[model samples]
Target: MNDWPPVRVLEAAPRWLRKVKAIILREIGSRYTGDALGYLWAYLVPLAWVLAVYVIFLLLGRRIPIDTDIGSFICSGVVPYVCSRYAVNAILRSRTAYRHILSFPTVSPNLVGGAVFALEMVNSLLIFGFLLLLNYSVFGFFEMHDPVLALWGYFLAVTSGGAFGYLMASLSTIVPALSRATPIFLRPLFYISGVFYTANELPPTLRDLFVWNPLFHGIEILRNGLFIGYESLFAMAWVPITFILVCVATGYIVQRRRLSGAPVEGDASWAI
Candidate 1:
């Protein structure tokens, strides 16, 4: 008889999934415990950003020539951008934040990182839903030409963001200095990631350069879904998908090596 313990293997699979879920729930609960505002901040902060951008555009007498209202257009871009940004920042701190949990042999760093990613994805969904409701009610802007396509774009943005966050988390663990500089490096992405403008609006040369940006593709694909007549000539779905897979693979390798007590380049004292 084989001593492989097939029954135990089956049992352990569900147990591991349950553990990941428990970690996610615990993180969400602990994150908003002391704050009275709780999860409302997740929706409110993004809503506030949309309103602020709308007002700024109004003041500047600038208007997007798209079929939908400016508010809706901005919402499509900003929501995903914010979600990805926060996901990266949160994941970067996940390993250190959950260091105590990592002591258990069953709880790997990747599992903890997955928990953090789940928390951000949940928050992003809430924020996205709230924005949709607000836009429909306040601005009467519910012109979703292709809901499936739009959803696919949103999915890509969130997943890619989570993967990028995981990568940053792994990098920061090995290089402490990167932990400090990550935010600064990410600041410029907001302006360039097609958050404020569509790829079509840029000149041909500029559009060529911007097309290489993965987030820009996400925003443009999202716009294609929201606005009926809008065409995103530069949007390529495979680019971001490829980038996400690469980031995730690299992050996983680095995380596994570090967790296995292998020697990592730079100071790994920051991990704890």
Candidate 2:
């Protein structure tokens, strides 16, 4: 006769959490495996963008009409835009990138996408820190009127990008054409998202229209945080927050159904 206590049962929520953590680590490792610079590139890429934009403005002999310095204005906008772009692209590619790994029961497409999104969040934070240092050292001015609000705005921006990316990921699986068309769709947003200018610069009607774009609100919130007198009076934080929540909720529903062995609408064989 053999006597043994029953094996401890792991709760489903905790098990999934563990799986997500493992996936995040594995993906980070794979992304930087052969690269010498590795994660340093994350910080460097944003810095390059900021510098490039600053130089362009300087060459054009155009000064930012805002109260804040040029460096603060540029960095505030560039960092958030870069983070949003990278986060969305990374999530859009997650399904295809981890298709094989997603075959495992514990590894779902949502998990892979979530892990990639989480990685982007971490990278964005690091980039923000680096920008702060650069702004302080080179520009000799870096003031945060509301650091907490700034961080909250940054989080919303990144989350909104990831949520939109998840929506795109789900749709691309249904309509293969979307996979090829996403970048083309996002091209217009670069100019329209208040990346190079502030929302307050616009006329009343134009500002009204621009504030609807979640990205504009994000940049405004970020600037408000960085500048002492700069207040984004037109932006209502709830708008982006609601949009992201809706996207995330819808994405979760679709992902859950897909993972439950339901056939995709257009492609039955599409297993993610």
Candidate 3:
């Protein structure tokens, strides 16, 4: 009979979790290293950004028209969008950034990009928490429609982002051009994805256009789940789930091919 009490395997679980935690801590530390203002600056920069946007929206006479509060409204969407951007960027460069360490058998290619994303998610949450605190303390906004849905939305976004990140990281090997063009492609998405406004306010034509945008759907559903207690303007879980499946399958296929020693070079970059 096989022995069930394997001390090494049990010990390895804690060790691996610790290693992952260490990676997160190291990434956070590196962000603040040599900066005079340090980590406070990290928290402050996003705060300033939100304040600027909030003031601008106020001047614009409530662009999205949130009757409850604007700061909390913006805070909900902005933080997640920022996290999405960071995750995409981090995953795209994970290959080159961790190329050295990836040569080792014990280290995983996904770990570098995934860890960066994980850490960034934590950072994003901290920023969101600050915004929540500010809204409650200063703006007198204390509304949480559906805590369960809100939590679910966060999990779904993180999962979708992580899966997409892994896929992009693997594809970068074959499509280096994507690495260059992805940022440019995603720029318009920030404003158009309904981050600063409600999708219900959009014109019929514009709403139709946004309905096709996957990120738009994700953000909208996420916001609805949290703000309206899962009463989304476009409540579709399939979109993000589909994107996750497609990306993961494609990334895994690409990883397998590359690991099998294919000549994966040249114009294959465009196909990705």
lDDT of each: 0.80, 0.79, 0.68
Give every collision pair in model 1. none
Candidate 2 residue spans exceeding 4 A from truth? 1-10, 34-36, 256-271
Per-residue accuracy of model 3 over 70-146 as CA lDDT, tens digit each: 77778766766666776776677666766666665555665566677777677666776777887899978766776
Per-candidate clash tally: 0, 0, 1
Better of 1 and 2 by TM-score: 1
Best by lDDT: 1
Per-residue lDDT over 34-143 for candidate 2, one digit per residue giving the tens place of the 0 to 100 score: 36688777778888999999999999997785787888888888888889888888898777778888777557677788878988899888888888888899879787
Q: Cα RMSD (Å) per model?
A: 3.6, 4.7, 4.9
| Candidate order (lDDT) | 1, 2, 3
- Lowest summed-lDDT stretch of 10 residues in model 1? 263-272
Ten contiguous residues minimizing lDDT sum, candidate 2: 1-10
Instruction: Give the TM-score of each candidate.
Output: 0.89, 0.87, 0.81
